[model samples]
Target: MAEARETLEEPILTGNGGPTDLAAMEPDLLDVEPDQTVASGRRRRSFQFGWWLACGWLILVVGAALLAPILPLWEPGTPDYTNVAGGLSASHPLGGDAIGRDNLSRLIYGARASLLVGLSAVVLGAVIGGLLGIIAGYVGGKVERVLLTLTDATLAFPGLVLLIAAVAVFGASMTVIIVGLAVLSIPTFIRLARATTLVIVQREFVTAARAYGARPMRVMLREVVPNVVLPVAAYGFIMVGVFIVAEGSLSFLGLGIPPPTPSWGSMIAAGRTELLTHPQISLIPAAVMFVTVLSINYVGERTRKRFEVKDSNL
Candidate 1:
């Protein structure tokens, strides 16, 4: 009798596999548990904190880089032989490098190189690529074919090898690095803007503007670009972090800004041999790079999600 009662209490499975009409069969199952609801809320709150933290770090790094010249820090290149490989102290807050140069100072100055390359490359790539992409997408025909063929060809090559070759051939000054990275970035933004423009071109507003006798240039600038820029810009934000890493990598490989100029990557390279004896030398700049990249990516992702939500709502 007890076994029969227990069997009858079990909810019947539907042909589709789930419990049949869960609400009718067991109303309690449809209701969310309190713990789950609270846990979800906590996760959302933690994400909010993380987003703000990421934004804060970016702001701090940018501000520090911009004001580095005026700040009363030791010159990045000045070395103290007596304090070689010293740990943290009043004079060297973060400590000294293998050569006794101020690690903190080098780290700050290095931000300039990283930021300069990252920002300039992305902006250049976006402007050039965005224009070509808009023209190709809005004026589809032979123009689209030619442009896309070039972009696809560029994309077909191995990116890192191409970058290395370009840097090697052109010489690895900051300008060469910036331009090389910009060229590398162009194909991506071209495809992104092209896809976005294609979507915007079909919209009712674009059609209405066209019907109102707007010139092609005006239509592209006023109608399509405004809609297309948001997503491209969002993607570009993420690309900034990537370009920073690229710049760092180039520096590490001796293809970036030369030594005595102080770059985060070069600092790491300089301190690499002493990693076991003076881990802080390499580790400090590495930590800064890690934080900087992580923060930029985190903020960019949040911005992308926000734009996506807005697009979905529209």
Candidate 2:
């Protein structure tokens, strides 16, 4: 008992033979928290500036698109022979297209197609890809190998070419476009989810849960999924703009929404012939698409960055 007491009472010594000062060591160990707090605060503040502008643009475009049917705007399909290739005017806010369609009205209506295809494709792709990725990552072995091979093959294919072929075979329709774009998006999400899950599955909490006799599915759903989802979702948000742009490209190439239906891509295609005579016809829709994409990208970038900061802090 005396020897045990002496051993317990002995001061812990450093390599230099000096008694270890636990109090001095505490500040170094705890210093990370305040620095991390400051960094997180800075990151939070960084989200304030310019974010509102991007949000405002999104709200404006979305609101305008949703309210288009009831809004006091001219008919999108109706032609005004008198205003053919006309510039901005009281009767036509943005101006008339080469076919005399009200540009502003068409623009508003076109948003429906663009946003629908963009958002829908992204969501579909994200959900399917995220699930597959999580399953493949957690299961590993043959399942992981097969899934990785499939994803690689998909990624290797030319997206635009695949889209064109699909359009030709399936007929150019919104549903086809959405599905094709979603297919293209799947590989990307799968890659992201798989990578994230691989890291998360190795975390201590996951091991603890498994040790507690939790089922694999339960551990995956409750532990792995919650951690893997945020980054993947953040990335998906950013990809929405990319898909929107892809939809526009399809429309521009005459493989998007059918004619007589207004879409930003179709509008630009229709107005391209009148570029020299009435640049506004093409430029206006093009500008709107540009601004919309820019705003989405800006907001998506901010969201991604915010998530990255959060992950770093964790």
True lDDT of residue 101, candidate 1: 89
Flag regions of model 1 displaced more than 4 Å: 1-47
Would you list the C-alpha lDDT of every candidate in the order shown?
0.86, 0.87
Name the TM-score of candidate 2: 0.86
Whose TM-score is greatest here? Answer: 2
Say which candidate scores most in lDDT.
2
Worst 10 residues of 1 by lDDT: 30-39
Residue-wise C-alpha lDDT for candidate 1, range 1-314, written one tens digit per residue: 33443464455455676647655556444432333433367777887899989989999889999999999898899998866999999988998988888888888899998899899999999999988998889999999999999999999988789878987788778888888889988989999999999999989999899899999899999999998898889888889989988888888788888778988889888888998989989889989999999999998888898678557645
Q: Give candidates' CA RMSD values in order.
A: 10.4, 7.6
Query: What's the alpha carbon RMSD for model 2?
Result: 7.6
